[model samples]
Target: MEKPRKTAIFSQVPTLEEPRIDANILIRLLQVAIDRDFEAAEVALLKTLIQDPCLNFQAVADKTGYQMYYLRGQVGPRLWADFTEVFGRSYGAEIGKRNFGDFIHCFLEKLSLMPNSFLQQDLEQHQIAQIFEPGEGEWAIAPSESWFYGRSKELDSLGKLLSQYRLVTLIGDVGVGKTALAARWTERFGAKSFDRVIWKSIAHAPEPDILLNELLQEFEVKELPQKLSEKMSVLMQIIKRQRCLIVLDSAESLIRTTAITALDPYTSPDYGRMIRFFAEEPHQSSLLFISRRRFNDVLRLSRANRAAATMRLEGLQPKEAQRIFEAHGLKNSSDWQRLIQIYAGNPQYLISISEYIQTVFSGSVQEFLRCDTVIVPDIVCQEYITQIQEINAEHRALLFHLAALKDPVHFDQLVVNLATSMKSQSALIKALNDLTEMNLVEKQQNNAILFGLNPIVKKVILSFPFIGGS
Candidate 1:
C-alpha cells in the first residue's frame, strides 16, 4: 500500500521539553566536541546528531567528530534567519548578546572571534555579556608594568609614530596584542603627554547616535545635541578643551556597507567626518585604531590618510617567547624554543599552551617536549579549520599530507609527492602560497617551506580518518 499523505496539522510539534536537540543543546554539544574529550564528546554528538528528531539543519555536526561551530561558514542573512527562527535569537545570543547584533539595521557590524572560542564557555560568556550590557573594559592595552615579554621594538615604533601623527593604525593577525600594546603605553605613560585617555571598542558597529549617547553617558555630559553634525561639533569642542587620547578599538568601526542606500546617513563619509572632526582634527589630541587588517584594505575610514603611520604587529620573537617561559620559571632553552614554535608567537596560544605545559611539567620544559605531539590542543585546530578552509584547496591538501606525515618531511620530495595527486606543479605552488598566507606553513632559511601547522592544527588533521590515506 502507498504511504499515507503527510498533513501539516498531523505533525507533532517539537518543544524544548521534547529532548530534541535545540540550538542550546546543539551549541553545547559542539563545545564538548572541541573540548577534545573525544570519548565523551563523541558519545554526546552522536546522540544529538545521529537521530536528530527531525531538525532543518543537517548533520553538519558529524562530517568530522569536531565542533558544529564551523558551519561551512555560510555566515549570510539566510543562515542567520534560519538559526534565529529555530533558536529564538542570533547565534550571538547563545554565545553572548552585546557583542553581536541586536535587531535590524545594526546587523553583523563585527566579524571577529574570541581566540579559540568554540571550546571555551568563559570567553563566550564575556562577549555575550556585551550584547545587552554596556562594558567599560572595552579597550585592551598591554600593561607596560606587567607586559613581561615580546615586541618592545614594535612598542617603541608605535610611540614614535604617534609622536608624529595625531592618529596611528595598528594592524596584525588575531592574538597579537595590538590593543594591549596600545593601552599599556597610553595608560602607563601617554597620560602625561596626552591629557586624557578614552578607550572604545567597535566590536559590533553601533549607530552614531548610540555611540554618541554612550560617550555622553560615560563622560556625564549634562546636555545632548540632536543632530549628528551638531553633536560632533559639541563633542569636538569638549575634546579640544581637554588634551585627549582616544583609542578606537576594533577595526570593524571603519567600515560602511559597499551597498549602503542614498538615504543612509551612516556613509563612509559621515563616519570619517565624525572621527576627523571630533577626534583627529581636535587640538593636541591623538587617536589610535587597533584592527586585524590594515583598516583601509577592508573599510575606508572617513579621512584616515593612506599615509597615516601604520604598524604590522608581527609574531612574538623567539627570544621574547622564551622570556615568557622563563618568567614562569621554566628553564631549558631548547625545550622552551620548541614550545614557542608550537604556538608561533600568538600570545593566546603561547599563554595557554605554556600554562598547560607548566601545569603538567612544572617548569620542566623537557617533559612537555618529550612527547612528539604538537603542543596545541584539538580545539585550537578545530577553531582554525574555517580559516584553513579559506586556504586554497590544493594547499590544504598539502597541509593534510604534511599533517599525516607528522614528522617534518623533506620539502621537494613532499612537493613532488603531493604534485602527482594534484593537477600540476603550478597548482602545488599556488596551494603553498595560500597556506603560507594563512600562516600554516613557513619557509626555512634555505627557502624550503614546510607546513608548520601549529601543533594543534597538525593533530586535528592527522586525527581525521582519511587525511592522507586518500
Candidate 2:
C-alpha cells in the first residue's frame, strides 16, 4: 500500500522565513486571552503549531499523538476562540485547520514588529495582556477558577498583607484552598505588581540547598554557589534588586517532627534560616509561604518583625459552599446548610462528599444526610491521618480528648481533662495553641473562650485505632 505524501499548509503562502517566537510567551498570551488555564490537549496542540508552523491537523496528530478528529473538533474551536481573543475577529473567522499555520506566522511577525517598551506600555494601559515570564523554579500553571467560589475578602486582605509585609505565611488546614488562593492572587496581580514571580513547592521536602539553587537558577545566575551561605547571599542580592514574589507551597513539609517535644518544636534548621533571612533581610521582594501549620520560626519572627505576617484561611461561606453542591448536580435540600456547616465549608471535602452522595444516594442530599452521622470521606480522613501522625503525642492526646467531648469546652475544663497525661497546665495550653495554629482545632469566644474540634476532625479522631473506633 502506498501512503499519500503530507503537504505543508504554508506552502501556498509567500516564500519568507518564519519569524522566531518564544513558545512560553505565546502560551501565556493564549492563557490570558481566554482567561483560563490551558489543558494538556490544548497545550499539545499549541506546541505542535509552534514546532512545525506548516503542519496540518493530520500531521499534528502524527507528531503529537492526538486524534485528528479531536484536533479539528474539540481543540480547534477553543483555540480559534483564543486566537480571536488575541488577534481580531478576521484571524479566527475561518474554521479551516489550514489557517493555523498562517495564524502562527502572522502572530510571530506581529510580535517582532512591536517594540518591547510598546508592549510594556500596552500591558500597563490594559490594551494588551501580559503575564510574568517564567523564572528559575517549577512554574506551576494557575488552576482554573471556573468553580472557585468566595474569598473576595481574603484576596483583598492578601493584597494589603503583601504591601505591608515582605514575608506572609498563608496557614490553613489540608484541602482548605491555601494553594488555590495563592495561585489565584498571583494570577490576578503578580505581573502588574512585581518584576518577577516564581512558584516552588516543597511537597517532596527538598533540602534548603537544592531549593536555593533552583531559585538562584530561576534568576539566571550562571555562577553557582557551592556553600549554602553563599547561595543565600546571592539570592538576597537578586531579590533586593528585582521585586519578586516567591511562593513556597507545602511549606509544612520543611518542619521536622520526629524529635518534637512539648517544650522544643523543631523545624528544618536550614529552612528556618532561609525563612528568617526572608523575614529579617531588607529586600524589595515578597515571599508567600503556604503551609498547613505555622512554623515555630515564623511565629517567633512574626512577633519581632513587622515585615512578617500570617493569615489563617477558613472554609467557604454558606452561600459560597452551596455553589459546590449546585455544580455537582446534587438536589437542593434543606439540609444543604447543615452539610456545609459539618464540613467546615471546605471545598475539597464538599466535592468529595458530593461525589459520594452521587454514587451512594443517587445525588440526593437529603437522603445522604438521613444517616444522621457525619460521614467523613475517606480521602479527607486519609489527609487528616497523615497530619495527625506528625504532631506530638501531647497534641494528639489533647485532640483525642476534645473529640471525646460532646460540646465545646473551656480551657480550664481541658486542663482538668488532660492533667494526668500532660506535665503541667502550661504544656496543655501550648498544645491547645499549637493545635489551634495548625487549624486542627477551633476556638469559639462567647462568655469565655471555648475550644472544640471541627465535626470532620472529631469524626476522624473517633475512628483512630488508639481511640478504640467510635
Minimal lDDT window, size 10, model 2: 3-12
Q: Rate the local accuracy (lDDT) of all candidates.
A: 0.51, 0.72
Which residue runs of candidate 2 sit more than 4 Å off their true CA positions? Answer: 1-140, 143-146, 258-266, 466-470
- Cα deviation of 370, candidate 2, in Å: 1.1
User: Which window of ten consecutive residues has the lowest lDDT sum in model 1?
Assistant: 96-105
Candidate 1 differs from the real structure by a C-alpha RMSD in angstroms, to one decimal, of 17.0
Q: Model 1, stretches more than 4 Å misplaced? A: 1-147, 252-282, 297-307, 377-470
Candidate 1 lDDT over 361-436, as tens digits, reads 6657787777766655444555455445434446567787777674665667776778666887766665565455
**Which candidate number has the best lDDT?**
2
**Distance from true position, residue 329, model 2, in Å?**
2.4
